[model samples]
Target: MNALKNEADNKKTIAIIQTTRIGDLLQTSHAVKLLKENHPEYRVVLVARKKFATPIMFLLEKVFDKVVTIEHKTAMFGADNVREALSKLKKQLKEINEQNIDVSINLAFSKSATYLHSLIESSNKVGPYFNDLHERVITDRWSQYLYSTVMRGDLNPFNLVDLFSSIIGTTKKLTHLSNKDYSSEKKTNLLIHPFASNEKKMWKANRWVEVIYQTLKKNENVKVYICGSNQDQKSADEILNSELIRPFKDRVNLWIGLDLKELYSKVDSSFLFVGHDSMIGNLLSFKNIKTLTISLGTVRPHETTPYALDNYNLAPKTECAPCFPKDECTEFKCHNDVPYNITHQCIGQLLNNNKINIEELNSSCSSLSLSRVKLYHSDMLDNGDLYIRESLHKDQDAKEVMRNFYHIAWTSIFTEINTSMDIPSFNIQTKAQLSSQSKGIETLYELSEFGKKYSRYIIEEISKNTPSLEEIRKFSAKLDEIDRLSDLVSTSYPLLAPVIDFAKVAKNNLQGNNLVKLSEAAFYTYNEISLMCSVLYEFFEKCSLINKSKPEARENI
Candidate 1:
């Protein structure tokens, strides 16, 4: 802490890099604002792409002492245009280096951002950056959490706003920008943004038409505004031309090609904002507008949903939902499953004459099976105000959530261990205990191998039209042995307790003459136990390194 204070005192220029799209850049603003408020002496600087930076230059200038723009689009044009873009980029880099930045924080996790961070001559660097060997190294714990757990795990409950705030050393609620009081405006207007960058994220044009038509029919005075950029004009036209929406054309306004200021003005005056996961939704969130987002396709509501006082998100209840962008899926059930009727109901309630009550809406709509829907609000605590909320799906069984959590946790631990195999040493007693634990993990691995073999044998027996009783008995006995070993290992290392409990539950659930079911269960158990073994192996290996490093410290242990 003293070292950090001395560093901050000596060099006060902090450079924050967020070379991403409009939404992500806007999201990073929370951290920027907090950083400025906390460290008033630190001259905060921003590095962003020119395209996005130009639109929000006014906001950035107000928050940051200086804003540096990178011509990212020109650089990516082609090989022919690369020389000029690189020359310009180099000039900008020289200007930034001249500022003698003390701290450089790369908020965007991209190859370009990492490369840029590596070039900056700063004493301290936070977030992800590339080493000389081109390996990505995340220096901050919060950033590592964002990369490892939040990006992949569905069980993560922290909002990105909270995570960003934490990374920059501020956990308090961010101070909102003062704007026109739009709360008093009548809730009859619905701002609908139907377009997203990804096709998978956009709802069917017909669905938008349905929502528009139903809203107009529900109330005579209700007006629907479809907002988008020039690129989305075609889709906006498709929705406006639909037969259902044609009659309401007089009431519907297509605010297309509006600049950032114009869009902010429209959203500010509007009563309710409804959209997919896109810049408009994020922008509205920045203004603290009441929004309802239909998160689908690759959008993870827990990660990207607009943050506001009472924003609502509707996502599918599928287990495979909120999947990775690279994950191939033929059905894309997330987009198809969101019922239009529910959307209509949500609109009606928001525009109702009575005051908005989020709790009422949540209670009434609980049966929709919207797993990741959450209400964002600030709660004051003794330490500071925080964005308090339950897990993505808090109502699910604790064990079920723990299963997913431990999988991601163990996987992340193993990945880190594999990357840097530097483990400290402990004393003789601790080394013995670690050795015993390693052996137990090896035993679990052996049990998993046997389970896999037994599953294969069961499949072979089914194929041969011969169900052997002796083989079944042997498999059951192996399962009993596995249970005993799991109990011992879990008792030694409490972290493996959940895995043992899950295995026991799964084993107990297997019943009747279900050979195929048994095979599947065996395969699943084998994979899960194998993962646990990997976790243990990495844990003991780290212990071994620790013992090797500090012989005297080991004696105290």
Candidate 2:
């Protein structure tokens, strides 16, 4: 406590580590700004990727006292590159260490970020880091929540900005200059960004044409500025050169390959910003511009939509709306389901002097059989102004959906463990009927015993100077038995069906001759099965103690 006091008295230096892409890095700026705004005495520093940092250095300079760039790509590649990067990294680390940073916060939940967090010396550290044992450790509750339940789970309602704010111990919502404050000149253009990191997130080129054509028809004077990276030029050309849109090319302006400052300038001057889920969308939201974001592919609109009252997100209604990696989509139904007419209507409403009646549009659009589209905007005040709606669907609160998902997941895990403990023991029966009745119980008992035996074998194999292929084959055979038993158990207990899938994935990974990967897979499978058995055993022990205490309870009765 005294040391912390002394550091504070001597003007502490706080470093924030965010080596992620531009969108995520921009989200962290709010937290960084709050840290400086609330504590003028503390020196705030930003450590970011060299490629991503240079483009946003001007904006970063406003919030942070200094910006430190790490050449992560070079540091992680070829031998010559590694040598040069290490030499530069040594000098950078030396300077950072000399600052005697009082607090260090790692905002990225990646392996590289974890390793970097381990290297930084600080009086206090928060977020994920790698331990000496090479294990990943998330030091804060919020970060752990993000990793375990929020990242892949459907029920997380808080936005990444909200999570970032919690990590830095601030409640300040992101504040940016209003569009009016930045640009007093007449806003005559609507900016459109039609590309994302992946094709799945992109609306079809024809859809872009429809939106632009509709917007121009509603207001002929408003010009459309199409914005994107240099890599996106081909796709941008496709949208602009489409036979349907070519006639209106005179009014469309291509703002390709613009730097961040230049892009910000265009966004500020535009009457409305329209795009899919991307960094620029978020950047526009950060600047408090009125934005219309279309959510397609794996984007969870509730989590990633830009933060602003006027910002609206349009998402398709699908069971697998936010599927990740997105490589599995043979037909991207989610993207196809979003009607371009809805986007056209949204743009028309924003550009029109009088707001279009939403109820009338909803009634009219309902007849078109377009997949149900919902508009979402930030609502909750405490959660860094979290996004919310009356309902994602009829009678379903979006927040409650996420909460219920978490509830069901935890309940399923607990039920499996508790049920495994209460399973009755089966004695061998000579009668066919009795044996048939006990089949499910017998299978579960066999699986439990096999799990223990397999775990012990793995331990023994790992202890050997060099375990032979024969031993590995034996372990694989045991895994096969577990899979068979799991299938039989799932017939009676449907909840245990995932166990079969888990075993199959482990087995598939073990097939290749990579000894290191095989060993890790074996250890991981063994540990998982062992944990299930251990929990069941603990429950069994507790049941025995309760039965033993029954005599005392009977006497009292």
Candidate 3:
């Protein structure tokens, strides 16, 4: 054991854990590069999900000593599945243990993160908690987690490359560490990531239409390159087919489904990146290239916005606010309403500003705080003044109320489709189905007169005595405290601790609910509630049977 320990102490072993989606994996890859560059001698290993392993593995092949792939989903879900995943993880742990890993950085923040510390056998485990997040010196922004050294804020927003580099202690600059070297080429083509992950996040097609028109009108020598995943080919094709955009088709090149390295090479060569708040925009910042990103909703530029070398972000003010899981609006009015002229004017200004050296332009990126934004409130609730006034006397009826509840549920389910699929490109049938189902629920809600009347009755009865959201939260926390106390009491008895613990868990989940990610809290609470309800119902039924049997015995007496 002394010899083994001595051998482990001789080498500096670092393990990076970021087993999430493709975008997150890519972001953490830059950190690996920075680590290798800074220390050069330390042995580094990256733990990635199977799906994200391929592209990032290929990118970081030469940077790290080894790439470790984990079955990300199995480890993420339940305790049993996590145990099973850990069994496989033990082998890697045994290997890294032999080397005595000095540092472990977790890029993901989930319930399963604790498992990584034990499996890796590392002394230093740093990551984001609800507290103790990191701050990047270059970007001057607090990173999402403790070990996350990557500074990604409004002024230094990044794609995966820049994010990774920041964490590893590099200057605030984007560098594409590709296998292929292109030292002699001049980039005449501009890469455009016009589509976003969601239609609501995408700049209007007309905006793209104008960008292409103006880009060609000014720099006739410059070519346009439209980029996306294979799933996005249809949208790209539609854009290509448009007569307005088609005139420049000869000068345009659509490169979807290219290999990751090839795409990076292309993006590296491009003069500018113009897109919405997609991963592509973030990726562009890594290359240290000029870019223009259009943002919408309550997505604070400081928190989630991209970092462009020489560019600007144009987001308009709206009444609905950053109603992120918005259902009331039939169409996404946020993205639809950003003025096209504003985009064109911004692009024109940057093009004229391109006379400066690229290095100076890169350093000139500015940070816009949530408070500094004058045109719009950080939250859309500020614009609630625009909403139609409501009176206390009016209330929705039962049928209408049922319809509204149904609509909220259906919309929530449809939203789940996007999250569940995790496809980067536009999925036609699924997208259409989501839209249709949501609209269908809305139509039902509007037509259900009986639901509306019954709902009104319930509302009238509850309105005079209803608790505010804050009160509900406090009450839920108090319930959790009571359950915790009950657990302490039951532990002494030992027989009822399981039931107490179960109640404690249910109450705790209710108190820490996140309204944005409704599925996480709602699903957990509903399951716990169902179990408790079933237990109580069974207990009552047994008691009623016992009482009837006693009465029968008394009759016999």
The estimated TM-scores of all candidates read 0.67, 0.69, 0.50
Kindly report which residue pairs in candidate 2 clash with one another.
155-402
For candidate 3, the TM-score is 0.50
> What lDDT does each candidate get?
0.64, 0.63, 0.45
Predicted candidate 1 versus true structure: per-residue lDDT over 61-108, tens digit per residue: 877888888875565563367677777667878988988887788878
Backbone clash total, candidate 3: 30
Q: Taking the tens digit of each residue's C-alpha lDDT, what string does model 2 give over 464-530?
A: 8997768867876776677676667756643233333434343443422455555555555544544
Q: How far is candidate 1 from the true structure (C-alpha RMSD, Å)?
A: 16.1
Q: Give the residue spans of candidate 3 off by over 4 A.
A: 1-11, 32-42, 74-99, 128-187, 268-270, 297-300, 304-311, 317-331, 355-557
Better of 1 and 2 by TM-score: 2
Model 3 lDDT tens row, 113-218: 4455445666655443222232111111112212221221111112344334433334322233331332233446677777766665676666687778777776
Q: Judged by lDDT against the true structure, how good is candidate 1?
A: 0.64
